[model samples]
Every structure is written in C-alpha cells, then in structure tokens.
Target chain A: MAKGFVAITAERCKGCGFCVEFCPTRVLALSSAFNSKGYHPPHIVSAEKCSGCDLCGMYCPDFAIFGGRYAR
Target chain B: MNEATLEIPYEIPEGARNPVEPFLRMDRMPHIWCAGCGIGTTVNCFTRALLDSKANLDKVAIVSGIGCTGRVAGYARLDSFHTTHGRAIPFATGLKLANPELQVVVYSGDGDLFAIGGNHFIHAARRNMDLKVICVNNMIYAMTGGQTAPTTPATAITATSPYGVSEPTFNLVALAEAAGASYVARWTTYHVKQLARSMEEVLKKKGFCFIEVISPCPTLYQRRNKMGDGLDAMKDYKAKSKVRNGAPTGECTLSKTGEIVVGKFVDRERPDYLELLKAQMIESLGDRYVEPEEACCSEC
Candidate 1:
C-alpha cells in the first residue's frame, strides 16, 4: 500500500484547481469527468507518491479534498 | 497522455472523514463562497490551527462582521456571533469583557475590519484587548459586487473604481503595529503552511493578535482585473511572495503587482486591557474595589 492517500468528494468541488496545481508530488490532475457542480474535480495521478502533507487540504477553498497517512 | 487524466483506481479508507469537516458545520457544506474564493482556505487554516492548539471548543467564540467572510461564524461549529457590518470588533470586545474565559476571535474581511470598522479596530488595538483577529483581504468588497476597498492596491479596477483607485492603500500590518497590537503577521492564501502556523501561535498568545491574510477573490476581483482565475492568483502569489520575518512593518506595503512581503512582522509582550483595568481598580479603590468574581451573584 502507498504510504498515504487522498480522499476526494467530487460533489463539493468548485474546480478552482488549487489542489491539482499545488500538490507537491504532482500526484493529482483535473479529471475529465464533471461533478454535480459541473466542475472538474481532481483525480489521483500518482497514488503512491502522495506525501499526505494535506497541503491540498489547506489550499482547497471548497473543502472538497483532504489527505491522510496510514498509522505506522 | 491518456494516463495523465485517468484517476488511479484506489479505495479510500473506510470511515475516513475530511479533517475540515469536524471544525465546520458540514450541513452548511457547499458553502456560499465562489469557486476559488480564498476565505474558505483561510477557514481551513483556522481549523488546523484550532486542532493543533487543542483549545477547548466551548471557550472559543467566533465573531464575524457583515461580509462574505462574515459568513464564517455561521459555518463554524464554535460559539458564533454574526454581528452587524463593521461591528465585529466591538461585539468581540463585549464578549471578552463579560466573560474573560472565552477565547474571542474576530473573523472578518478587509472591508469589514479596515474600512467599515476601522475606528473600532484602532481603539481595540490601542487598549491591547485580548482578541485574535483574522482579516481576509480580498482587496475589494467582494459580496457587494466588487467595490474598491481601503486595502485595494492602486490601479486595481473595481465596480466603484473603474479608472483605478487614486487613494493610497492602507498598510494593515503597519497600522496594527502602530496601534499597539501585541502580535501581527500577514500571509497570502497561497502560503497555507505559514498562515496556519501563525494562527496556531495566536491562539496561545495574550494581548491583541492580528493576522492579515491576502486572499484571492476570483469571482469578482480576479475576473474584473483580468486575472485568469483563482489558480492563477495563487501562482502569482507564489512568484511574487517573499518571506521576511520581522521585517519592519512600515516597509511591508502591498502593491497591485510587486514583491509581496509576508511573515511575522511583530511579536512582543504587552499588558492586555483586562490586566490594566484590574491594576487601576486595585490602585484606586484599594479595599473598596471588589473583585469581579467576588461580586454578589444575581441570585443573591
């Protein structure tokens, strides 16, 4: 398993793309699919590379995306 | 190229909840902030700060004035008061005075704090009230359809200032420092880590603490100014920002397009309002000055 993972609630996303743009590992990208808000929520591009820093969470203005690491 | 857009098929941990959910009123989710609004980003930083500090939830009171940022009180799960426009500081002052146990926080926008409630802010800071203030500066009055605000940089076109503002912008950090704030710092929404750290620091700090967050108003400010979107604004901040911790507050003036100075400008010790009041009473009244707690209860 990857050291960490990110969970995305697509419906809550407004698609400002802060998470995808600022993700340190470049682990995410805007998906082609649209959410209920008609915005493209981010999808994991490199799941194993996620550092679970939650920088994505801090930058997510919509409160749509957050990351966490499994307990050691 | 096809793989770039493809989502990695992975299962989210069972029962995992977003970290921001607990700090916020989730039923009020899908908040009114427009896509790319940095107010929510500031809220995220605040929640993290609250959690990291492990403050008693019941003792924290979130007070907000009228504006988009004012809605923060409604969305937060803490003791909240959405006061009239520009009155958040006065209301917070009352809360702190009536019940000094509560950690009173005034969360409002630049227009609300610096423009509408500018006088109240200066006096509160002068008294060194035990209040933690978070000012989200989007540079314009966003909710009122983008009117130019006191902090709006020169040459920014807004609904009220089509030809660009002629008046000089207020240096918020300088004002706070001059007005006697015990702690003052400024950060952009893009500087999430630093912002959260400062918020955490303020939670434990006494006297008046102020943090000014320069946020992106993508819907109005950005769109009107021809800045592509909220993401573009973040990229702009990344390219321009300089972290000069403890830089003289007067030199930290924000411009429309210039190097952004951000960091802790002032962190010093000062006696707060309550302490001064207690000292004065003790000196003047001596035995006649009854302690607030020792005063007879209403039931008596």
Candidate 2:
C-alpha cells in the first residue's frame, strides 16, 4: 500500500510536467491521456514511491497536483 | 476530451479541493497563464506564506501594476487592486498611508516594478515604508511577447532585442538592499519552500521588505533561447543555485546559465515611514501635536 497519494485536478492541469519532473520519489509521469484542452496531464507511476512531501504541489504552476501522506 | 472521459491514472477521490483553492478565485478557473508559466507557482507560495503567517485576510491588501504577474491582484481572494502600468508601488504607498493597519503588498513583474516604476520603488524603500514588495523577475516581458526587460540577462535574445541584448542587467537584490529595505532575499521558483518561508518572515516583520523571485518564462524566454520548457529551467536552477545566507548583496550577479546565489542577503531594523513620522511629530510639535485618530469607518 502507498504511504501517501497525490490528488490531481486533471481539468486544471496545463501539462507543464513540473510536478512529474520534480517529484523526489519519481512517482508521476506525463500520461498519454489528454485533458479537455488537449494538454497531457501527469499520472501516478509508482504509488508506493510517493512520500507525500507536496514538493509536486509546490512545483506545479497550474495548481493542479498536490500530495498528502496517509494517516498512520 | 472531457474530464470524465479522460481518466487520470491516479485514483483521485471526489470533491477533493487543492489546498490552494480557497486562496484563489476558483470562478476564474483556467487562469490566463501559459502552459509552463511560473507566476501561478509564486502565487501558491504566497498563499502558503499567508497561511503560515496567519494574516488577517480582511486587513491584507494586494496591489499590482500592469504585466503578466500583475494579474495576481485580480486572481487573489483578498482586498486587491489592479493599478495602472508601473504604478503599483505608488498605489501601495497611498494605500498604506490611508490605513496603517492594513498589511499592503506590492506584487508585479520586473518590467512593471523595475523598468517603469523604478523611481517609486526606490522612494518607497528609502522611506522604509511598511510594504511587502514581491518582484517576479522573469527577465523578459512575457505578456508583451517577451520584450527585453530591465532585469533581462546580457546576450539573451528577447522580442525587442533580436540581435541579443548588449546592455548590462539590473542587480535586483543589490538594488533592494541599497534602497534601504529592512529585509532582502532572492529565490527562484525551484526553491519554493525557502521562498515561502522568506515571504512569511517578511509578513511578520515590519518596514520595507523585498523578495525577488526569479521565475521561468518557458513559452517565450526559454523557447526563444532553446532552453527547453519550464522543467528544464527549473532543473538548471536546482543544479546551479548556491544558498549563502548573509552574503553581500552587491556580489550577487545573475548571468545566463551561471551559478545563482540565493538566500537572505540583508536583514536590519529601520524605522518605517509611519514610525519615523510619529517620532518626528512627537519631538518637534511637543504638546501641539495630536495623535491622528484610528479609522473612523468601521468597514475600513
């Protein structure tokens, strides 16, 4: 089970890939799927790798992705 | 592709709002920024800073001058004013004088703040006005088709400077310190945590506080210079940045593809304009001086 998860507002994403490129744990990647505006948003790659540091949240210029650690 | 049709690979819970949602005007969803613009990221740090500072939303006012970053005032969910081009500092000064209780923040782009409103910025800092100035220095003027701004690094090709800019660039950190700011710091978008922390510190402290945020303009600056996208610029920032606290402000030089010195360069306490005025009045006027009553209007 993953220790943390990222919640993405796919519709708000502009596909800049900042979150995917900067995620310390390499948990996300730009998905082939496109949003309504035709930009490729990111998707989870290895759920367990997510540390929920929210560095993705800080790097995301579009304010689309944010991470959180699950309560123990 | 509708949101429902395109399934994001992650299992997202329904009705989950991004923590930044409340601070932003959600109705203005889909902001006007480009795919890799960094202004919104700065806004995220700012909102986080505000949260950490525990500032009263009602008493915090955001002022902006015309430019891409200037749009922050409109998007922020607070008492915000979108002023004329290059006039954000003057407007903020007036706002601060009118209501001393309000924590006034002047947020604008490099062109708006340094190029046109240059004098206003220096004067405000000289007076040690209690204002928070956040300059998002993207180097080029992104909104105006990437024109060469005052802070644009040398040899960088901009819209207006087709032959490559030959003129020297402005040292924003040095300028802020020389202008008499009580606190000065420089950070790039990649250093979001430090940037947010510095911003929070500025809010808690008084007097003129300036934070220069070097952000990426991928659509224009990066693409024109063949520097790839926003992520590439961020990677460069991450690899080359050196954080030296208390480093002399005059030595912080920003060159194209060179090591960037980032950290708090100056922090000193100086009487703000309001404080100086009060002290002078009490000394000179003696018994004749009467304290100005607080805001009469309850809704101020």
Candidate 3:
C-alpha cells in the first residue's frame, strides 16, 4: 500500500474545515494553534492513513492544503 | 538531566505545491472569495481543464464581466480582459475576430451573463461565433448582495425577493440550443471531473460553446435562503443531479427542489462566423477582395 502526506499553508487556511470534513480517510484534524489569520489550519493526525487523493486540495477554496504520495 | 530525555522534533515534510498554481496568479493568493464559496472549486477545475487540454497558453485569452465569478479573468495568469458589465461576450467576439488564431473564453456569473448580457448571449450563439463561455450560476447576484437573478429558481428568497421569486427562470441549456450554440453542457462544482472534461471539449471545439456551472454562494445566497452551506449544496447536488448525456435541452429545466438534469446536451459541427464571413466575402467581392494576409501592412 502506498503512503501519503499532507501539508497546509498556515495563513492561507480560513478555518472553513472543508479539507478536514471532506477527507475520505479521516487523516486530518484542525490544529488548536491558530495561524496569523486567526484561523485553525488542518494538521495531519494520521499520516500513515493518507491516500493522497487530493480531494481536500480540490475542495479547498483557500488553496491552503495539498496531499501527495510517497515511494516505499 | 537524563541523556535520552531530549525530545527529537518531528521534521515536517515540504508542502506539496498546488497543481493549479502554475495557471493562477500567485501574487493574488488568498482569493477574495468567502470561505466555502464554490467559485474557487470551479476555478480549480478550469485550471485543470486548461492543463489537460494542452492548449497554447499564450494564444488563450479570458474575458469576464462584473460579478464574483467575473473576477476569474483577473486571477488567471494569461491574457485576460475584465470588461464592463454585460459586455464580456462582445468584447471576446472582437478579440476572436481580430485574431482568429486566439482562443477566447468568457467567464462570468449568472446576473452578469443572463441578465444584462442576455441579449448578447443569444446573438453570439445565433451567429455561431467561436467562443467558449463558462457561466457560473450561483442562483442569485452574490457580489452586490444576494438579489434575485434571471437564473434564480422560482420561490427562492433573495434580498430583492424577500417574499420568494415569483418569476420563472431561464433554462440556459434550452436557450443556448435554441440560439444555435455548437456545444452546450451543464455541471455543478460537485461534478468537477465532468465539468473539467466539458471545459476541455469546449476548448478543442469551435463555435459558441457555453457551460453552465451550478456553484454555491455560501455568504449571501445560501445564508439568506437557509440552504445550509457550501458543503450542503454539494451534497444536494450529489443527491439531486442526474447525468443523462444527449438529453433534450427542453427537459433540463431546474426546479426549486427537483432533480437537476446535467450533461453535454449538444455537440454538432457548424460553420462559425469567421468562416461564413470569409466565404461571403470571396463570393461577393471576387478579385476585388484582398485576403487578410495580402491586406496586412498595405499602408506601410
């Protein structure tokens, strides 16, 4: 099985939670720490479970988060 | 202090660059769209379509009118024109005529395209001009506040229509077909793959190609109408939409709470405006007519 990773731009996230809500594998969660924009960006809660589908990226209006796969 | 007690920090991997970044103006990052607005999703699909189509980016031009979706032209890292309200179609028509090699696309919202620009829309399709038009229908006028628009579904409450809109809405697919657009399709932001595919098809096709993207406006339209939020609208689209390719345009009418018919309705070959113009000129003017190439730089 291929592993995946997720990354988010802190300031770009508006805390709409679209990425977190739309993640198919439940790999992401909103961080308690707030960005400069006073919004809680998504954080990788389960990196090993990410499939890198990038649907989160597709649905994110802010262009804040992206997902990618890694070679074993 | 214990020697092994130091906490080794977990190194964060480098963030993956957004695939659509190349097509977007990064300096204009953090687009002004409200959180949960579907315009951004449409933009994502559009940029992906452009990349998938492998179009000559330099030869592509985007034109838009005054509205939220009209802002799309400004964010695209291409030759773009933000024209006056209801003038994007004619402006793009002039651009296509001046240089037939250029692929001109007009991106605008419902009110901008279907209201004030409604006449231009029909005539452009009537002439069969080679223009790709993407009309994002959020149902209401979102930019100037949630007001009743020509595409607004009947009985929807808007700022201007507090008691519910009593007028019937224009069926865009029917109108486009009736006016003679060579290609016509409809999709929602939820149907990103289909929308992108349609965009690619229209890019490669000639004549007036129109795509109506049903997007959500969470800020005004959704909030006023109590339509949940952007995600809810996507869920609604997923539940209500029925994809039936080649369905008659007359059967694609949208209702307040009925099934949404979506798909590519029309695709046919037609002699576009420029081709007809050249043929007419050749027959009428005979030897007196100078080809554009021959007329080029004649004064110099």
Candidate 4:
C-alpha cells in the first residue's frame, strides 16, 4: 500500500533540478549517480522528513513526480 | 566495380531516422531567413536538443517575442505562444506560474530581450524563475530592416548606424548571470554540437537558465559590414572567439583582438520564484484562485 502518493518516477526523471529547486520543504535531492539515460535523477533525500507538501511534484517540468494523483 | 569511377549507394539506417523530421515540415524548407543566416542552424540545434533530452513532448511549451527568432515558437510541435514584441518573458513567466509542470522556453533575438524587454529579462533572471531562455545574438536587428541593437558591435554599419554606430554592444550572458540566473552559457552557431549539449543541460537545470547563441545575420549585418556569407561569419567567430570557461562575473567587455570567451558561463543553485509564491499563496488564501493583475502596469 502506497500511503504517500508522492513519488518520483526514476525512468522518466531527467534531472532538470526543478524538483530540487521547487521543493518548499527541501524534500527532493538529485543523486550524483546517473540513471539509465546517463543523467542524474531526483531522489527522496529526506522522505521521513517529508510533509506531503507536493511542491516537487507540482513544479517538475516533466510528469516525473506525482502527488496524491492531483497533479497540476 | 571500377576503381576510377565507381558510384557508391548508401542507405540510412531504418532505426536511425532523422529526429528533426516529423517534428519539422521539410516542405517549409529554405525558410524566409536571409542567405547566410544562422537561424536555420540554431533551429536545428534546438530540435536536436529536444530529441537528445527526450523530454515529454506534450509537456513542452515554446514562447517567443517579435524577431526572426520569435517566429520559432510557431514552428515547434508543442504548446507555443507567439507573443508580442519584447514581451515573451512575461508571458512565459505567467505560463510557468500557472502550471510549473510545463517546460517553458523563451526563444528570441537579442534586440527583443536586451533592448525592448530588457527590464523583464533582468527581473526574470533576478527572480530565478524556472524557465529556459535562448537568445540569438546576430548583432544588428535583422527583421526590422537592419537597425542598430544592443548587441551590435560599436561602429558597425547599419541602416540606423551610418558612420559606424558609436554605442557599445551589450554582453547578454554576463547580464543574465549578474541578474541571478541559475544557469548561463554562451556559444556560437559554429559549435552546433556544443550548443545542443548546452541546451540540453539548461533544459534540465532547475532555476532560470539563459543561453546566448552568437548567430549570423548575413542579409542584414553581413551585407552592411561586408562580413561575407554566414559561413564567413562563422569563420570570424572561430577565429575571434576565445573559449573561456568559468570566467568571473562582472561588466563584459569585447576587445578588438582578444578572445570572445564562450563556454558554460555560469551555473548555480537558487530557489525558484514560483514555488515561493505558491507557498505564500497556500498560506494566504488556502489554494483559492488569486486575482490576476488587470492592467499592463507596474502594479502587475
């Protein structure tokens, strides 16, 4: 059961830094390690510290992040 | 097969198709751009970047102001805005705020960004808005019949500048970096691959990203300056340009014989403006619709 609807789709993420920049609670962090696309991907740097704020999900240019299925 | 006059037939790989096509309407080949213009190459680089990044097509939005480059937004197969002269930044700003999920990009000529909408450009960078701006610097204003522009080299002949305009040109990359843009880069049309890679980098960057492409305006600037064809302009760029990476930020000056330093000019981290505003909105109105500014005034 996925309690928190907010999650990052690693394959779709392009490491554009939007999530990291827009996260109001500083919940998202871009890993130095590259994904399958040879580019960095965003991660849940402090998931335990997340407030379910959904800022990262809302600001992502790609639909890489989803939150509560109420994405903008 | 005879060694002296053998003709070889080559076929393109079926899987390795040209990505620019389908996205581009080749029937529209030889666009209205003047001979020796770099706009074609610039447009090619952009489309290539889009393909290389593999960004979500439906989630992209291209915005532009009035100029040769401004016409680019209309050609792209994405949600595009053919905005007013020198006002693409504000329009893009609105679009980004309304839906930050869209990849909003502003593609405009130097005059549009540096002269008419200079203030908006500065403030947009200062706010660190989550957007990408690709400004094509062809020195003189080409579309409006070749007039002197902020990027026009001093003493350059133009319809408006008869005895070599006395005014100095603007260093756009430096301006954006100083204004707080999180990502900034400068490249010439000669460096197609480099420009494409830079565009991809900026597309993935978090905050406001600014890229200045030194393109050629052969019909306008070249004819007036006797700079020959667009290829000649590229040759000039290669000869005159001095590649400088991570240069210190300050007032940008162009010396006659020195390098025209171009590279990843700036990359930094900053909180984007829209998210901050969103947080402020949630605190104030509890997710209600905020009234938009009515008039095109300073109050907005």
Candidate 5:
C-alpha cells in the first residue's frame, strides 16, 4: 500500500486541533513545541499510518497543513 | 559503486507549498477565529473554489461587512475590502458596476448581512447585481457575545435570549429567491466538497448569487446553547442535513430540530444589472449614445 505524509507549517498553526481531530487515521497529535505565536501545532505521531487523505487540510481554516502520498 | 551507496536519497521536495497558500495572506498567520470555528472551513472551500474556477486573482475582489466572517476579506490575498456593518452589499455593488470585469464577492456574517444590512441585501438581489454573496450563518452574533440574530433558530438560547428566542427567523434561501436572485444554495461546513463546488458554480454565474453556510460558533453560540463543540455540531449536521436539489425555496426553512434542507435550491438565468443598463441605453439613444471605452477605466 502507498503511504501518505503530511507536512505542517508550525508557525501558521493556531493550535486549533481541527487537523488532528479530523484525521481519519489518527496520525496527528498536538505537539508540546510552540511556535513564535506560542500556539501548539500538529505533529505526525504514527507516520506509517498516515493515509494522505488531506482531510486535515480541508477542515483546517489556518491553511497551516497539507498532505500527499508516497510509495514506501 | 556498491548497491547501498548507489541508492538515491529519498527526500521530500524542498519549498513545498500548501495548495491553498497562494489564496491566503500568509503574513496574517494565527487567524483570530476560535478553535473549531467553521468560518475557516468556509474559507478553505472558498479558496478551493477560486482555484477550481480559474478566476483571475488580480481581477477578483472580496468585500465583507463587520462581523467574524467579515475578517475573510482581510485574510484573502486578493483585492478585498472590509466595509462597515451591513454595507458590504452596497459596496460590492459599486465595485461591480465600476468594474464589470472584476468578480466581486461579498463574504459576511448573518447578523451583518441580514439584520443591519437586510435592506441592502433585498435591493441587491432585486436588482440581480452580479455579485457572489457568501453568508456564514452561525445562528448567533458570535463576535458580540452570542446575541440572537435574524438567522437564529426559533426558541434557541442566546446571549440576549436567555428565555429562548421567540421571534420568527428569516428564511434566507426563500428571501434570496423572493428578491429575484439568480442563484441560491445552502451548505454546512461538514459538506466541504459540495460547498466548494457550489462556490465554483457561483463564480461562473453572472447574476446575484447567494450561498448560506451554516457553521458552528463553538466559543459563543454552541457553548451558550449547550450545543457541544464544533465537531459535535458538525456531527449533528451530518445526521440531520437533507439534500434536495431544486427544492422549493419556501420549504427550506431551518427548524430548531427538523432536518436541514441543504442543496442547490435555485439556479436560473436572468439579465444582470449591467446587461439591462447597456440594453436600455442602446435603445434610448440609438446611434447617438457612445459606449464607454471600458466599463471602469481608471484612466478615464
């Protein structure tokens, strides 16, 4: 199966968790690290499990995250 | 070279850009909307629509009135205006009339568009002005402490309606149709794909187009009314929304507990304001009237 990955621009994330909450594969989690704005951004937890569905990007209002597919 | 050493390094491309980045003003990071606020979702769909419609970004303009949704104009990277409360429609009208080539979009909240700006809304629709109006109906005045709004559902608890709202709410879809709008649709944040498609259609359309986005205000409206958070509201929408394309506008009213009728309620053709004006001038003046070299030439 092809694996998908997501890249999150930390600085733009407002720690809304919409991306994490809406991720069907539950591969995202809010990170302890904070950006300059002091907001927690989403990070990949189970990289291998990502489906690259891009639901996180669709539901995200911040435009801080995006997803794509890759062959393992 | 050894097989291990000959392997190409697998690396994600550098400078990868988010697909929606070009449509947004990245400098305005960390937008003011609360967590789970549906306004951003609407923005996402809208930006996607802009991309899908192949609209000329330089010639597109976004106008917004004062409200939470009004902030859309500021976030959009295209030509945008943050107008006064309830005045976004009129402002957009002027922009469209002055520059017929430009695609004018009015993004605003229900309170600002329907309450304080109700008169402008009716008139704009009646004239069938060439404008795309996206009204985010969060059911309450989110920025103003969850006050009851014209789009608020009857008997819904709000900041100003502690005892539950008693006034009848405005059926926006019906109102738009009655006022002679050429295109009308309604969708929720949960329906992202559909919403984006609808926005694309609106952009391609010529006459007055209105899309009501039923979103959740988690911070104010939901919390005050015990409607749970944004996700919960979205879940309810998923369960309760009914899609009836081309349904009668009069049957599209949103009830407190009834199923939400969501779909393309109206789609038709009509001569827009500028088209009518040009025809009238040609008929009245015959060969004497001279057409302007350009619709709104800045040099002229």
Candidate 6:
C-alpha cells in the first residue's frame, strides 16, 4: 500500500506560493483555475507518486495541509 | 607586603546579568543596528527596566512598528507583536484595553512614531490610555536606506534630503505632554540610568506614558551624514546634551545652534481611560459581566 500524504486546507491558504515552489519532488502545482476568493489554487500534480516528504506542509503559511497514508 | 596574594572576590558589574545569555532572541541578535549603535543600549535599558519593575513577565506584551527600533519587539523575551510601521500605538492601545492587566509597551523608531503614526500617537495620548510608548529617535530614518524623518534635524543629509532636510523636527516630549499623556520624558542612550528610571516610571503610570530615547544610528544616519562612528556619536551625545529637567520646548531643539535638552520633561496623574471604561462597563453590565460559572460550556 502507498503511504498517505497530508491534506491542505484550501480556504485558509494565503497563496504565498511557498509550497508550490519549495517541494523538491515537484508534486504540487498552482492550477490555472481559481478558488472562491479568485486566487490561484494549489493542486497535487502527482497524487499517486507522492514521496511523503512533507515539504509542502512545512512551507505552507496557513497550516493548511496535513499528510498521511491513503485510506480505503 | 602580601601584594602577591590579594584574594579578589569574583564580581559582576552592577545590574549585570549574563551578558551572553540573551533575554531577547539570538536569531534576531546583532540586529540591523550599526556596530556599537546606541539602540542596543536602549534595548538593554528596557530589559533592565523590566527587571527593575518586577513586572509579571508573562503578563508583559511588547508591540513594535517598523524601523530599526521596531526590531526590538522580536527579540524581547515576552509576548511580543511586530506590527506594521507607525501603527504600534494603536495596536498597543487595543491590547491594553482588551487585557487591562497586561503591561503593554509600544517600542518604535522616530520615523515609525512621529512620521507615519503621528496622528495615532497624538490621539492615543489624548485618550490617556494605560500604555507605555518608547519612541527611539535617531534623528533620522535609519531603516529604508536613510531618509529625513519627522525628527530629522534641518540641514541633515539623507537619501530623500540630499540638499538638506529644510524642515524643523518635532519635540516628542512636548508633543506627548500637549496631547495629554499622563507621563512624558526624553533621555538619550548615554543617560542609561535615567532612561531606565524613566522607563520604570512610565511602566507604573496609570495613563498613557511616552519616553523618547535619543539613540544613534551610526551606520545609515552617521555614515551618510558624516557624523562619525558609533562611539564618536555617543561622545557627541554626551558632550552636546545639556541637562535641564523642565526646559521649555523651544530650548530642546536638536540643532547645532540649539541646546540638546535631556531629562524628564513632564509627569502628571489623570483618570486613566481603561479604568473609566471599566467603570462604565460595570455600571451598564449590572452583574452580567460578573456572572460566574464553574466548568462552563457553551453550545454554539
């Protein structure tokens, strides 16, 4: 079973762009689509290939994300 | 005849407590202060004031606006808020009103307080709220690459005032006293003991208290203006400053031809704003505020 990863709270994210630029594995990306507030939303580019590095969570300003193993 | 065995007792200087052991954050240590800058001396005076006041460490909150002096809040060992430029007074006012028991202090630079936040400063003083504000005036805006601040002397060389400041500076003590602050004082870093005493007095004052500490920013202000190094700047402060406790505002101007008056300029007692508000609160609430319940839970 693949190890699960953290979740990011979409609403609280300040859109500082730290997580998208920091993750070494290049798993996160800013989508062209916008959130309710009209800012760019962060999205997982490779959910199935997550390395569980936790870099995104560390760099996030809003404490929006948490990671764990995938659930059934 | 026993000169060889003059057993000396190991001693520390008066008010000396572990110089290397930082009561402020070391990560923020060696702040943007110029080498031997006097702001650090002011920071030391503040820490000493805290120790002298024996104020509840946990109940103390320091708020700072942007500039060189604003960095002090980040380093102090207490609940500190590093807020935006010139907004520390308003932020501290809110904090004091909210918690009444907290020792709220707003430490800011000349530019932050007298320039951008001048209106707030005057209004806060007029309200006479229970808060202490320490405005560190280096006579120039040491941050933002040296500009002519509200406290900058006329004819000072600065990035924005390449020709000369062409503007007279504000006398902060008079400004506070006229605005109705209960306590007002001005002291330079060379007057460390006096500054500490002023801080102590302000800490205990019931209404708004303002202490303007004249500090030296040798790096930006001095280097660009040819004011010499930090030590030289300090020597200048010591030699040029004239001691006058209650000198009129006109005599304290920071000019080559004017006397640099330094001392406690004003002190008075008045009904504090928070106390008045609390009295009004109790009168209106009529025991609702006093409603006591143990192990309380609320269902939202």
lDDT of 5 by residue, B232-271 (tens): 8888898999999999999999977789999999999999
lDDT of 3 by residue, B1-300 (tens): 121221112233555478788888999887888877888888888887898999999999999999999999999999999999999999999898878889999999989998999999999999999999999999989999899999999999999999999999999999999999999999988888799899999999999999999998888888877888887888889899999999999999998779999999999999999888889998999888875553245477
RMSD of each: 2.4, 1.9, 4.2, 16.4, 5.2, 19.1
lDDT of 4 by residue, B228-280 (tens): 76656666787888677787645345532346778887988888996677677
Q: After superposition, how far is residue B93 of candidate 4 from its true place, in Å?
A: 1.0
Clashing pairs in 5: none
Ten consecutive residues with minimal summed lDDT in candidate 4 chain B?
B1-10
DockQ for each numbered candidate: 0.64, 0.60, 0.40, 0.01, 0.36, 0.01
Which has the higher DockQ value, candidate number 1 or candidate number 2? 1
**TM-score (second chain) of model 3:** 0.93
Proportion of the native interface contacts kept in model 1:
0.76
- Model 2 residue runs over 4 Å out of place are B1-15, B298-300
lDDT of 1 by residue, B1-300 (tens): 233354456777788788889989888887999998899999999999999999998999999999999999999999999999999999999888888988999999999999989999999999999999999999999999999999999999999999988899999999999999999999999999999999999999999999999999988898878988888999999999999999999999999999999999999999999999999999999989976663346898
In what order do the candidates fall by DockQ, top score first? 1, 2, 3, 5, 4, 6
Model 1 chain B poorest 10 in a row by lDDT: B1-10
For candidate 3, the docking band is: acceptable
* TM-score list, all predictions: 0.96, 0.95, 0.91, 0.72, 0.90, 0.71
Interface RMSD list for the candidates: 3.3, 2.4, 6.7, 19.3, 8.8, 27.0
Residue B266 displacement in candidate 5 (angstroms): 0.9
- Tell me chain A's TM-score in each of the predictions: 0.95, 0.95, 0.90, 0.75, 0.91, 0.75
After best superposition, candidate 6 residue B240: deviation in angstroms?
A: 1.5
**Which clashing pairs does model 3 show?**
none
Across residues B146-236, which tens digit of lDDT does each residue of candidate 2 receive?
9998888999998999989999999999998998999999999999999999999999999999999999899889888899888888888
After superposition, the stretches of candidate 5 with alpha carbons farther than 4 Å from their true spots are A1-3, A10-17, A24-26, A29-41, A49-51, A70-72, B1-12, B293-300
Cα distance off (Å), candidate 5, residue B112? 0.8
After superposition, which runs of candidate 6 have C-alpha atoms over 4 Å from their true positions?
A1-72, B1-22, B279-300
Best candidate, TM-score-wise? 1
